[model samples]
Target: MRAVTVRPGAKDSVEVGEVPDPVPADGDLLVDALAVGVCGTDKEIARGEYGTAPPGGERLVLGHESLGRVRQAPPGSGFSAGDLVAGVVRRPDPEPCGACARGEFDMCRNGRYTERGIKELDGYGSEAWRVEAEYAVKLEPHLDRVGVLMEPTTVVAKAWEQVERVGARSWFEPQRVLVTGAGPIGLLATLLGIQRGLEVHVLDRVTEGPKPGLVRDLGATYHAKDIEQVISAVCPDIVIEATGANEPVLASLTGTAPYGVVCLTGVSPSGRRATVDAGAVNREIVLQNDAVVGSVNANLRHYRQAADALAEADPAWLERVITRRVPLERAAEAFREQPDDVKVVIEF
Candidate 1:
C-alpha cells in the first residue's frame, strides 16, 4: 500500500510511496482510505514546523482529517464492513491523566496525548489504515461525498461546546455571533452558529471569493472590513475567533457585547509579537464579565456531534466547502495555497 509519509522536521519531505499494508489489532477496524483533508497543521508538518513520527520510526503518515470505508470490523463492535467512518485523532496517554481517564483526552493536562498523524502515531494517510473500534465514528451514508470534512467539523463542534459551557456560567441568551476568518474552520463555525438560530456574521480579508457568497447563502452576513470596524458594527454576543492572526484575535478579546463568550479555535504561531493594551483588555473583560477560551482538538463526543451536524447540513453546501481535491499521487500539491480554495482534500 502507498501512503503519504513525511520525515518530521524535514522541510518538503512529503512523498507517496509503497508502505506495508495495515494490520488490525484486537477490536480494531480496518478501513480503506477514501480521502484526507489538508489543513494548516498538515502544511506545518510538511514545512518541518510541526509533527512527529511514531517512536523509533523515520517517517510519519501525514493526515488527521481522515475519511474512509470500513473493510473489516470485529463482531459486536456496532460497526460493519462498508460503513463510512472517520477515525478519532487523539489517544489518551499511557499514564492517564484525570481527564483522559474519563475519556476526555482532548483535555489532557499531562500534555502527553498521542494524536494520529500528529504526535507519535502513524496517521490515516495510507491506502488503508486500522483504528480502534471505539475511536471510529460512523458517518451517515449520504455524507459519502463530503464526509472528508468530518474532522474539521469536529473541531468547530468542540469550539461551540466550549462557548456554550462558558456561557452557562450566567444568564446567556446570545443572538449574534461574529466568526473571524473565512477559512473552513471559521465557515464551519458559522454553520454551527446558524444551526443554533443565531445571527452569524463572518469576517475575512478576501473581498472577492466564494467565501462571501458562501456566507450569504448560509443566511449570514459577510464582512471584509477591518476587524475593529466589523466588530463594532456587529456588537456580537459571541465571537468565534478562527483567524489565528494577531489583529482579529486582539480585537475579539474586547469586541463582544456585555457578558460575551469568545471561543478561540485558531492556533497562532509563537514569537509573533503584538502590541496590546493589557490594562484595557483586562478592564473590558472584568467590567463586562466576558469570557475568552481557547479550544483545539476533539474527543469522541465531539466527533459524534460533528457527524450529526454534517448530516443535517446541505450536501451541496458541504460540497462547495471542498474547493479542491488532489489525488494521492500529487498529495503535496494540496498543501500549496490556491486562490479560491476553501478546503483541499487528498483523495486516495
Candidate 2:
C-alpha cells in the first residue's frame, strides 16, 4: 500500500511511498481510506513546523481529516464492513489526567494527549489504517462526497458547545452571531449558527468568489468591508473568531455586546504582535459580563454532534465546501492552495 510519509521536523520530507498493508490487531477495526482533508495543520507539518511520529519511527503519515469505509470489524464492535466512518484524532495520555480520565482527551490538562497525524501516531492518509472501535464514529450515507469535512465541523461543534456553556452563565438568548472569516471553519460555524436559528453574519477579506455567494445562499449576511462596520451593524450577541489573524482576534476580544459570548477557534501565530487596547477589552468583558473562550479538538460527544449536524445538512451545500479534490498520487500538489480554494481533499 501507498502512504504519504513525512519526517516530522525536516523540511521537504513529504513524499508518496509504499508501506505494508494494515495488520489488524486484537480489538482493532480495519478501515479503507476514501479521502482525507488537507488543512493548514497538514501544510505546517510538511514544512517541519509541527508533527510527531510514532515512538522510534522516523517517518510519519501526514493526514488527520479522514473519511473511510469499514473493511473489517470485530464481532459486536457496533460497526459493519461497509459503514462510512471518521476516526477521532486525539487519544488519552498514559497518565490519563483528570479530563482524559473522563474520556475528554481533547482537554487533557497535562498536555500529553496524542493526535493522529499530528502527534505520535500515523494518520489515515493512505490506502488503509486501523482504528479502535471506540474512536471511530459512523456517518450518514448521504455524506459520501463531503464526509471528509466531518473533522473540521467537529472543531466548530466544540466551539459552539463552549459558547452555549458560557452563555448559560446568565439568562442568555442569543439572536445574532458574527463569524470572522469565511474559510471552512468559519462557514461551518455559520451553518451551525443558522441551524440554531440565529441571524448569522460572516466577514472575510475576499471581495469576490464563491465565499460571498456561499454565505448569502445560506441566508446569512456576508461582509467584505472593515470588521468594525459589520460588527457595529450586527451588534452580535455571539462572535466566533475563526481567523487567528491579529485584527479579527482583537476585534472579537474587544466587542461590547453585553452578555455576549466570543469563541476563538483559530490558532494564531506567535510573535505576530498587534496593538490592542487591553484596558478597554478588559473593561468590556468585566462590565458587560461577556465570555470569551477558545476551543480545539473534539471529544466523542462533539464528534457525535458533528455527525448529526452533517447528516441533517443538505448534501448539495456540504459538497460545495470541498472546492478541490485530487488523487493520492497528486497529494503533494494538493497542498498548493489556489486563491479561491475552500477545502481541498486527497482521494485515496
Per residue, candidate 1 scores C-alpha lDDT tens digits across 172-217 of 8999999999999999999999899999999999989789999999
- The segments of candidate 1 whose C-alpha lies over 4 angstroms from its true place after superposition are none
Give all TM-scores, in the order shown: 0.99, 0.99
Using lDDT as the measure, the top candidate is 1
Tell me the whole-model lDDT of each prediction, alpha carbons only.
0.95, 0.91
Worst 10 residues of 2 by lDDT: 248-257
Model 2, 55-150: lDDT tens digits are 999999988999999999999999999999999999999989999999988899999999999999999898999999999999998787899999
Error of 1 at 175 (Å): 0.1
Cα lDDT for residue 8, model 2?
94
Error of 2 at 78 (Å): 0.6
Clashing pairs in 1: none
How far out, in Å, is residue 111 in model 2?
Answer: 1.0
